[model samples]
Target: MKILILKRDKLGDMLLTTPMFALLRQHFPGARIDVLANTYNAWVIDGNTDVSRVWSYQRVKEGGRIHWRAAFAQLRQTLALRAEEYDWIIVANGDASHRAIKRAAWLGGCNLVSYTDAKNSHRKVNHPLEIPRQIHEARRMANLLTPLGISLPEVLPPLRFQLPAEAQTFANQWLAEQGLTPGSYITLGLGARRAKKQPTTEQIIRWTRHFHEAWGLKTVFMWTPGKSDNPMYPGDDETAQPVLDAKLPWLVPFRGPLKPALGLIFNGRTSLFPDSGLMHFAAASPGGVLGFFAETDVSPAPAQWGPVGPRARWLEAPKAVSQLEDASVFAELESLLK
Candidate 1:
């Protein structure tokens, strides 16, 4: 069987699709599975045992109606995908954008399955799975496999991110050069798609100080430099500067690329984040993570996108990070450490 998975999204969205890949392999052991993912998120699907190959989809807006250039570009890409003659094409994640429906149809497969919350999108696909509200995102993707007779676990497995051997070597050398011990340091991911989700620099400083004083764990800050040109959570580096400028005794700065940063996360005692890509990264890691998420009536809550793992914990605020208290954050960290 030849199967194609269309999961072209950002880090968390891409990572959440890993369970579906595993389930597909379990149901159809001999099937050749290919994944269509964004250039940024291609790494998440890469090196997976279940996926035969990963096709890069560079243009996030390719299927959208707004830009003719992107639509034309998608047409060209679709021609190549259609040639593969996949027996089944599954659109694992769906936005309100009509582009997802357009892209799925354009790929031209024998059986096309998709999940969407929109009523209009339900009419366009062969199998349109209506996603349930307030469930973890991974479970929503896993629901796509029900048509194939795959029964998923009550608690889906954590997102999978495989770092290369070089990343591990780089992390070890970087930590050694910084005079830090492995498993005795905490990593603070200081990037957020929205300013409201980000905890103040003062909050980070105070928490780091507490962890340092109480647990003797030195803190390191990591961030991705957000670029305006990128549509998907370009990330912000500015959040890290305040912590650095404060020259806090226990704080260290180790900002760089994603894979190597993930290597450091793998070895760290624990990490903290504010609904950023790093939260997903740390959730994929073996290390513990405390994620702070803010949701209003319009936004999805922690119950929907919270981290999943034995050691992963999430604290939800009403509308912004400012609504969450510092002591509550510390208490969560203390509990995670225990």
Candidate 2:
């Protein structure tokens, strides 16, 4: 059997579907399970064992004009996929109106499974499942497999992100240079998609001191690597500067590519982050993860997108994350650490 799973989305969204890949492998051990991921999030599944192959494509940014060369390349890839004659094509994204489902239908798969909402009631999905109003994204992805007799477990497995051997080596060397060892420190990610979701510099300093005094663990601060002015992918250079300027010996600053950064997070005792891609990466690690999310009525609740794992925990503030009291934040941290 051959299957195609479409999850060409953001980093967090791609990570959420990892459990479904594992379940598919277990159910059909010999089946070839491939994934259609985008260039941005394909790294999440680089070393994943369950996926037979990963096909990646670039996504044009919203409102950006599509280049002819890129369009032709996409068309070629789509035609190739249609030729594969997959037994099943599952649109693993939670959104009912995701364009990937329409592409799946065009692929002429023998069986197509996807979500159906009021807006997408007419989409051609052979096995249509209504989008669940209240469920973790991982569970929502798992629901797509029900048509194949794969049932959701009471407890979904944690997100999966395997570090490559090279990255592990780099992490080990970097830690040695800094006189640190695995599980001996904590990581604090300083980047969030929106500035409002991040904790203030003073708050970060307080947290660092608290962690050091309470538990002898040093803190490693990681942030996005480019200037905020970059049009393509704005980063947190300005946001991280104040914390870095403090020059606290115990507060190590890290700015690099995603893989090595992930390696460092995986080796830490635990990690703290705002609601961002790094938070999702940390959730996949063996160490505990704590995420601070902003609550907004217009967006999906933190309960849906927040980290999911035995060791993952999150706190939500009604307005901006700055509104969360230090006492409440520390209390949640105490519970998570214990």
Candidate 3:
């Protein structure tokens, strides 16, 4: 049997659906399990034993109807996917993967299912079952298998990852070259796709300085390719009016490690970021993580199937969900570090 899971979204969201890949493997055992993700998330699927292949697709939106370009891409992908003779395909991303769903069904199709909430998305197919939006997405993803006779495992499944052999070596050498030794170093992940979720430049600087001074750990500013340098943290009139012009290193350029950089911090290398793949990578690894997720109400915990382990401490604001206060964030971080 062959299976494919399609979920197209942000890095953090992809991190959530990984557990379902494992569940499929457990239920089916001998089948080829795969994930059809986006270009931005193909790397997360690497080092996974459960999945056989990772396919990437761009968001196909046009005319408020699936665009012709996107449709062509889907036709090519689905037609090729049909050749694999898959027995099942799980569209975990959203109702948007409906194109894949229909195409897969038309060409030597398979058992088709998708994860969607009637409250948030329209019912585009026959598989979606309504579930709580914030009820630990990983759990919900795995639960999707229960009705299908896939027995639930006893152990708390984790979103798994196998650190690339080369990356592990690179990380070791990277840290050594930076004069960074093992122990409890803090990865000050301070990048976010939106300004609202990210702290103001001044806030980030103050947070980094405080963590370094208090913990004696090095600060790592998480960076993403093509993401413009964030010189300012988010501020608005209706919300917390950020105190700026504090002469801080808030707008500091990313002068640290390189992408796929070989570096680790205090025996407990950690990362702090506003919902990005780097942060997820840290979470996916055994390393510690302090994740600040705003905008959405998703959980920080990695999928319960992957090799990468648990999220040490996840801090998010309540309601409208972004814009964390310094004092409150510190209190939370203090607890986690201990």
Candidate 4:
């Protein structure tokens, strides 16, 4: 069967959806599974084993979000997707990706698309996230296709991607050029979809340099577009923007493709990121590690959002072991050095 999984979100969001790719492969065995994502999130699946193809959509400005241009692109993609005669199209987004699916179906001539009718957009779609049983977003996606008489073993599937041998070699060469080694390095995610979701800029600087000095961990800072310039994605709409928008101006303006941000999470020794998509990617990578904090907690104290499985040790704190106190994080990072 031909399958299309649609996920139009940030990098980490796409990464989480990837685990479902593994599950789909196991259940269908011979299905031709493909994914549709925003341009920024497209590369996350570049070397993924389970997915057979990728389709990318442009991230448009809020003013012209679903304008004629977007409509034309959607129409074209949907028409192409229609040619595939997908036996199933699982939209991996909650309400957010549903919009894309609706457009695609309108354009593609396939009306039977599935996605999490998530709380975030339930009112719009008016469809409850039924099959997935309304659990984690990842689980919900897996649930969507389960109705098609597919089920995998009870064990959770993993998200994975292989660096092209040359890419791996190039990455190693890049590391060597920086005089860095994997164990002796710490990577910091300096950008987020929401600026308030991040630890302060001063915190990032202190944490990275501190770890470098105390643990001898070389540093890598993930950068996004116009971050130093505008520092925030021009939000949903100025009037509809979250009020905290005024408080967070130092973050990345994030108008470029999100691929670079997703790419940033893979190499870190431990990530200090909020509960966003990159955190999921870092947690899911072959041997990835992260320090995750909950975005649910909006306090000034940084939260640690780490890998949830054997590959990570999730750290949650009002204890203040932050990306700011780099020296302290360096000490904690020692355990992962080997």
Candidate 5:
């Protein structure tokens, strides 16, 4: 049997789809399971044990005008995907838009599965899975498989990713050079695509001081690679400069690919994040996490996208990021670390 999952979304969405991959593996251990995701987020599934392979494509920004060359590239990739002749193609977490559904069906599959709300006419999918809009995104995705007679697990599994032994060893050696080791340091995942949702700059410094002074754990500041001229990937180097310049001997900066970074988290004590892909990475790691979430109209709420793990906990802002009190968040972190 062959199955393909279309999760052409960003990092957080792809991480939430991990449970669906787990379910597919449990139900059809012999089947080959593949995923189609955005190039930037394809790493989320790179080391997934349940997924057989990951196919990637660049994501065109929504509402941004696409040039003819970019459009042609997407078309060529879609045609190549259609040649795979998959037995089942599941469009996980896509809406009922004509463009999205059409692409899912266009991939040349015997059966196409996806979800729809009551308002949708159900014209886009061969297997239309109806579900509520407000539930946790992971559970909502898992429930889509019920029509196939796959009994739901009583408890949803945690998000997951795997790292090679070499990667772990490299991380350990690097930590040793820095006078650190597993379970002795914490990572602060700074920078989100959406900057408004993050705590104020002042708040981060205060929080770092509190963590260092109270928990007695060294801190690693993490950020994505970015250019100074481009706004698209404004790396947190500028944001992290103050803490770096403070000459606080306990802080270190990490900037690199997701795999080794996951390795670092895998060997670490705990982490704090402001609703970024790093939160998902930490949740997948065998470590603890404290994720701060602020209300946003543009994206899903924290209840729907917060970290999921036995040791993972999240704090929802009382109102907005500007109004969030750093003291309250530190209090929550104190409890989690203890």
Candidate 6:
């Protein structure tokens, strides 16, 4: 048997679909399971044993016009995928749209499985499942497997993110240089794609001090590595500068590639983040994860996108995350640690 999962989305969204990969491997041990991810998120499953292979293409931004070359490349890749003649092609996203369904149909699978909504019907999907409303993203994705006789478990499994050996080595070396050990510190991620979701610099400093004074754990500060002015990949260099310049002994700054950063986060006691991709990465790791969400009309609510795991917890602010009181955030962290 052969299966192809289309999860060509953001980093956090890609991580959410990992449970589906594990379930597929468990149910069909002999099946060749593969994934079609995008360049941005392919690393999430780089060394995952459940996936036989991974095929990736550059993802064009939504509503942005695609260059002719990029469009041709995508067409060529899609044609190649169609040639594979997969037994099943599952659109792994929860709210698969009409365009997403049509794209999966082009993949030429014997069975095309996806979710159906008002905009998209079952006519295109050989096996269609109704989209589950206001559920964890992982469980919502697992619903698609019902057609193959795989039932959703009462509790979903933890998310997966495999760290490469070299990345692990890099993290270990860096930790040694800083006189730190695994689980002795917290990873503090200071980047959020949205302005309203980010905590203020004062809030960040306060949180770092609270971790040290309350939990006696140092903080390893990290941020998206780039200039904020870059339109393609806006980062938190400017936002992180003041905190980094503070010269706080308990705070160590980290700046590097995503893989090694994952290594550091995996080794930490826990990771604190605003609603961002790094938060999802920490949730997938073995360490504890705490995230803050600012509910907005354009974004999915915490009910759907919140972290999932015994050690994972998220606090949603009624308005912007900046408005969340330091005492409330600290209280939630204490609960998470307990």
Quote the positional error of residue 294 for candidate 6 in Å.
Answer: 1.4
Could you tell me every candidate's TM-score relative to the true structure?
0.87, 0.90, 0.69, 0.68, 0.82, 0.88
The digit string of per-residue lDDT tens for model 6 on 1-338 reads: 99998886778888888888888998999999999877878888988888999988776654466667766888999999999999998988888577678878888989999988777855658798878887878888888888888988887666777777888999899999999999889998865877678788788889899899889999999989898878778888888898888889899999887888989998998888888778888887777688888865667677888887777888787778888988888877787676
Model 1 C-alpha lDDT versus the unseen true structure:
0.78
Q: Taking the tens digit of each residue's C-alpha lDDT, what string does model 5 give over 91-134? A: 77745544556678778788888876555534547788765567
Residue 198 displacement in candidate 2 (angstroms): 1.1
Q: Say which candidate scores most in TM-score.
A: 2
Alpha-carbon RMSD, each predicted model: 3.4, 2.4, 6.3, 7.4, 3.7, 2.8
What candidate 4 gets wrong by more than 4 Å, as runs, is 57-73, 96-98, 107-128, 131-134, 152-154, 164-174, 193-197, 200-214, 223-268, 294-309, 317-335
Candidate 1 off by > 4 Å = 60-77, 94-96, 116-124, 226-237
Better-scoring candidate (lDDT), 1 or 5: 1
Could you give the candidate ranking by TM-score, starting with the highest? 2, 6, 1, 5, 3, 4
lDDT of 2 by residue, 190-214 (tens): 7686877888898889888888888
What's model 5's TM-score?
Answer: 0.82
Q: What shift in Å separates residue 132 of candidate 4 from its native position after superposition?
A: 6.1
Poorly placed runs, candidate 6 (over 4 Å): 58-80, 118-123, 296-298, 335-338
Regions more than 4 Å wrong, model 2: 60-69, 121-123, 229-231, 334-338
User: Considering lDDT, which of the candidate structures 2 and 5 is the better prediction for this target?
Assistant: 2
Q: Between the candidate structures 1 and 6, which one is better when assessed by TM-score? A: 6
